[model samples]
Target: MLDLHNHTTRCKHATGTMSEYVDTALSQGVSVYGFACHAPMDYDTGFRMSFDELQDYFHDIETLQERYSGRCTIRKGLEVDYLPKHLDSRVLDADVDYLIGSVHFLDDWGFDNPQFISEYMRQDMSQCWQRYLHAIRDMAKSGLFQIVGHFDLLKIFNNPPDDSVHEAITQTLESIKSAGMALEINSAGLRKPIGEIYPSKQILRKAFALGIPITFGSDAHAVQQVGFGRESAQRLAKEVGYTKMLDFHNRSPIVCRIP
Candidate 1:
């Protein structure tokens, strides 16, 4: 199995060290395990690693990669939040294995935060949904990321908007396809209150129909959670007619069989 979205204590919200996660991946028999901790933002968010700590983050991952050389492939990546003008350009220019673009905030208001759920509720649900989709499309079209993370994270509250957002969803998928970026079938949602994978079955079907390549991510925050829910993600992919999943190195995709 291959899992590209994982977190470490550097992300503040997650637990475990890079070595611990690597050991867990080895135990899970994961063929390729990536440490994609939240990328450092220019300002303090208290959730991501600070810019000053980014070098050490890279060093730690590199050290682990050498330490576990022949046992399993360990990659270094970042779960970069797309904030339009706010993102540091250096992150895109960083020498990393890959980048996972995600939208955790809707213009500064973190819609996925449990503490911010009340704030999300105060907005017009329909408009908020549309805006979230737009942000995703913009992120895809930006041409900076290799994969899109948690495709429908705005539904974190379990209160989905009406079905009138079809056009927006279509555009987002099309943008991802046109950008030649892969979409992650993230399993972290199962741990959330929503209790389902990100990008839901509906979105996954649309992405499959659009010919967008897919990848698997456990989005694990702890050592024990590494490769969590991969079996369910694989079944979902096959049900949607996906025959191959993507693996990345130096930001280039390598096709792998869906097993």
Candidate 2:
């Protein structure tokens, strides 16, 4: 199995050391694993790493890669938020295996944060949904990331917009296809109130029809969560007619059979 999205203590909300995560992946029989801790933003969010810690984060992963060389493949990566003006170009220029671009905030309201749930409730659901989708499309067209993380994370509260949101979703998928970026089938949503994977079956089917390349990400924040829900992710891909999943090395893709 392969999982490309994971977090560490550097991302304040997550637990476990880089070694612990690698050990857990080995136990889970994961052949390829990527450490993609939330990248640091220009300002403090309290959930991600600090800008100064980025070098340490990269070095730690590099050390683990050598330590676990024969046991499993470990790729260095980051889950970078798509904040246009605040984006840290270092993340894009850094020597890493891949980058997972995600939309976690709309303007200043972070829709995914638990503390901001009430703030999300106050906004017009339709407007928020449309804005979120447009942000994702912009992230895809930016050409700075190799993977799109959790395409439908706005449904974290189970308040997904109506079918009218399809146009925006289609536009985002088309942008990702044009940018040659892969859509991540994130399994973390299962642990949230949403109780389903990101991008839903509806979106997944459309992405398949659009010939968008797919990748799997557990979005693990802890050791036990590594490779969690991988089987379900694979089943969803198979049902959508996907025979393979894309893996990355230095931002280049390698096709592997969906297992």
Which one wins on lDDT? 2
lDDT of 1: 0.88
Candidate 1 wrongly placed segments (more than 4 Å):
none
TM-score of 2: 0.97
> Across residues 40-82, which tens digit of lDDT does each residue of candidate 2 receive?
8885469899889999999898888899898899999999999
RMSD of 1: 1.1
Q: How many clashes (backbone N, Cα, C below 3 Å) per candidate?
A: 0, 0
lDDT of each: 0.88, 0.89
User: Model 1 clash pairs?
Assistant: none
Find the 10 residues in a row with the least total lDDT in model 2.
116-125
What tens digits encode model 1's per-residue C-alpha lDDT throughout 6-114?
9989888888777888888788788898989899896446889988898899999889889889898888899999997768966888889899999988777877878
Candidate 2 pairs with clashing backbones? none
